[model samples]
Target: MNYYKDNVSTNVVTSNCNYVVTVKDWPAFLNEYNNFSNTTLAAYNAAYLQLGGGGNVAPGVSFLLKFGAFLNLYKADPSSDEYMPLKLNQNNA
Candidate 1:
């Protein structure tokens, strides 16, 4: 599986079924994420146009900005109340 940011693969991991995989290149991943977060609308719009602009790209961009902002906040202070742990259901597989 590949984790992507700004349509670029940042990390790649292979898994079969019974083992755990760790992302060893955290710095590279963070760099890619920061790049995506700092992308300007003009750049995004240009890319969108190049991809055959058919739908409004504003909403997608807005979502990325919002999510990136939240991530930044969490990175700044993981102990902050704004950070919440997701509760996963134990019964679900």
Candidate 2:
């Protein structure tokens, strides 16, 4: 998905740190699954849990996927799944 371009419309600094929203009918949902401000990692985990438990099967605003949750936790290795400092550790080892 072109998750970057559109989300920047909302906030650029938080764009790279955002999670993609796959729930198609989120605008119709409520409670713990409604607020746009619910961008924490915990909130993101909750949403995915709900989906795994048989939530909606449709795609929401395809453009707003990365706009739902905040994803900038720790630094990631740009070239791999390892943490950002993994390469440094490897070299020193």
Question: By TM-score, who's the top model here?
Answer: 1
Residue-by-residue lDDT tens digits, candidate 1, 1-93: 255432332221223212112233556557766866799978866655544333444332333333332322111133232332222233310
Error in Å for residue 84 of model 1: 32
Q: List the candidates' TM-scores in order.
A: 0.22, 0.19
- Candidate 1: stretches off by over 4 Å: 1-22, 41-93
Tens digits of lDDT, candidate 2, 1-93: 446433432222232343222332323433434564568878775665465343432222212233333322223323434432111123221
Clashes per candidate, residues 3 or more apart or on different chains: 0, 7
Give lDDT per model, in order. 0.37, 0.35
Q: Residue 27 deviation, candidate 2, in Å? A: 20
Q: How close is candidate 1 to the true structure, as a TM-score?
A: 0.22
Report clash pairs, candidate 1: none
Model 1 C-alpha lDDT versus the unseen true structure = 0.37
Error of 1 at 91 (Å): 42
